[model samples]
Target: MPFIPHTDEDITGMLDVIGVDSIDALFDEIPKELRAKELAGVPSGLSEMEVTQLLQARARIDGEPTCFIGAGAYDHHIPAAVWQITTRGEFYSAYTPYQAEASQGTLQVLYEFQSMMTALTGLDVSNASLYDGASALAEAVLMAVRANRKVKTTRVLMPRSVHPFYRRTVRSIVQHQGIDLVEVDFDTETGQTTLAHCETAGDEPFAALVVPQPNVFGVLEDVNALTDWAQSRDALVIGVVNPVALALLSPPGDWGQNGADIACGEGQPLGMPLASGGPYLGFLCCQQAFIRQLPGRIAGKTEDVDGKVGYTLTLQAREQHIRRSKATSNICTNQGLLVTAATVHMAILGAEGLERVAAACLANTDRLAQQLCEVPGVEPIFEAPAFHERALRLPAPTEDVLAALAEQDILGGFDLGREYPELGCALLVCATERRTDAEIAAYREALASTLAIAEAA
Candidate 1:
């Protein structure tokens, strides 16, 4: 743990052992112009004490807001008890439970986490965790392809309204594997994934269909009908869902009961911080039919020789440690700490409490949407009811309105026009349980004034 700089002798010995003369020779393939002369803007060196103070000072330049800005990563009220419990030394700096016999506590927590995720998603089984929601979805897609071995066409149909990041993540994962990626468009009025478009796209011999519940636009999909449509064609249906929405909305496992193969989503809103976007948990769950295709390690309950109940890693086919390159997925590590935080948060806020949280968030979002609609230039873009997020069309350009709102230290909604040109002046705004009545009023007032200026300009 002590800092010791490598001496000339040490470098010489290492280089000689590797048959290399100089460090620069290691980058023979890198273009000369691309190589930095001296890390141009950075200072060469600083004393340890100076570096510490510099880092502290730089960190003091906080970019975080004191108020609401919930999109994907929310601003929920994390209980102090969560911090108190998760910070315990036994759990805080723990590593993976590779040695099953030695890591009983670690494995037990993971088992509990898996059980909680199963309950949340309404799936029969759940994996320990994945890196994040996007990766989980990518893994699910890969799993579907693997399950549909008889299918000649390796195609996955995703919705255009699925989180743009999730879509990109799926594409990135499948592109190299030679799977066809089909993105279903939205019904312009509902802002929901179009089943008509899916019917058109689903004609091809496809491996699976990926749909999100309370999708990117926050419009809930008809999971039953969608799952039926996919299964009728003998294709796997994967739903990327919001766990909070699942409290009020139908669970994807319910879709599995109606016939879906996989369910996955980012578990951030359950109890993780925005932390400028992550260190969040990725939840993947499914019925026993496709359990073999589940990507991450699974924690299953069992009885020891003493006849006492215990937990251990089970059905771990996707991990590299078990199967190497031929594995279903290569996610070596799960989001353990984040998953533990969520498990604790969920335990404290039981079923009724979780539903109450969801209801409060939905109520706040509805109220905010109604208030914002009063602004002359602002109008709700979709007719369908959303859970805790919505898309609104500004009478003026989104950039102008956002810039004006930002001047008041209010982070406005994400601009949809940036990604979908035909969406015109639409902005995607989200509100959660954390946004107070006063803050919602403030955001409305700010948007009203900002919109007036935008329209005039």
Candidate 2:
């Protein structure tokens, strides 16, 4: 689509209507330093043919290296059918269906997505979607605050071991809103986020406590224990889970069976590509009691006069559109396109297939870790149970190691120094189903060479 389709006459009409002499006059802010000095040096506008070739060439350039990089968005294998169905003109072009009648198809997909998320989390109610995992967690916090029904609680406990980015995001969203983020410590050796660090009182209490199962470090947490700790107070427990890990470990709902209140997580592993960080779906689900407090949309099934089952947007009262400040949450738009993609992916890979994918990820990560241990200067950080990712403390600084690996076209893992400075020279590694045994061996060989070079230097 032409972003600005202005004909000569249309431009003239607009300028005339605005009483402007030339377009440059509109930006006459009297700041030469800020504005480009003489229209800048560049080629004249290209013809359609030239522009197409230039863009195609740029698109073909491979930016990311040939190996691992998954903090949250994984490098899992996406089936061809995903793209085939997602690219359908009808699904691609559809936007928010304000009119329930006109958007039945979209509504139905959302309904199914909600059902699947609910089933996956083992929660009674699931919202259609939220923005992404971070936003979903922020919404979950707000929901917990509202559920308190007492004086708005000032503090919420988040584990230091949770995704550092997610903790930062939660802080950004709630700081201005007058909420204190209490950082709970984790067992350095075990990599478990324990609730013992939090000091709660009857009057001055936590509104909610957010912890990830198989947290950012990839260690499986004793979620039942965490849940029990939170419930002792009236604090709501929010579990930020990786949907794929549910296959190997217990689901959050089962954690709820012990005592969890709400669940929120990134749904990217279900089939969405990393896509350079997103357009990924954030999934949120809660117990039936908290359904009214959940943010975003909910598609419910209803019957028509003729006795046919039809899906329609239900529970509109919790959103900003209806309740404003008093709304359950301000999340206005659910990631419709990404949510549909996740739904399709889930349908294609049923419960059994999901387990297989999870198994592959687990096995690959184990292999990667095993190979890394063989390298002279590398050591696995913790002796904890991880789902499909882990951290390795190397002999040299992580950046130096990363630079060496880049020479071999291996992307390598995220560096832990920026967040966990205590873990001085650790490289966080992730392995998904997409990584093969041969590729892992190559990574091992490359990493070994890099370590040796760094040591010799």
TM-score of each: 0.88, 0.89
lDDT of 1 by residue, 237-291 (tens): 8889888778888777777347566889889977887777788988899877778
- Native-to-model Cα distance after best TM-score fit, residue 187 in candidate 2, in Å: 0.9
Who wins the lDDT comparison? Answer: 2
Residue pairs in collision within model 1: 256-260
Determine the C-alpha RMSD for candidate 2 after optimal superposition of all C-alphas: 4.5
Model 1: residues >4 Å from true position, as ranges? 1-56, 63-68, 149-152
lDDT tens digits by residue: candidate 2, 1-457: 2467878888788889989987887888768679766655786778789999998888787655666777887988877898788878788898876777778888999999988988888878898988889888888887787776544686788888889888888878877778777788887888887655555323467788887987888988889878877777767889999998877778788874455778999998888888778888889999888888888999989877898888888888777888898887767888888888888898998888899999999889999999988999789888888888888999998998898898778988999877899888988898899898888998999999888888899
Residue 1, candidate 2: Cα error in Å is 9.8
**lDDT of candidate model 1 versus the reference:** 0.82
Number of the predicted model whose TM-score against the real structure is largest = 2
Clashes of each: 1, 0
Error of 2 at 164 (Å): 0.7
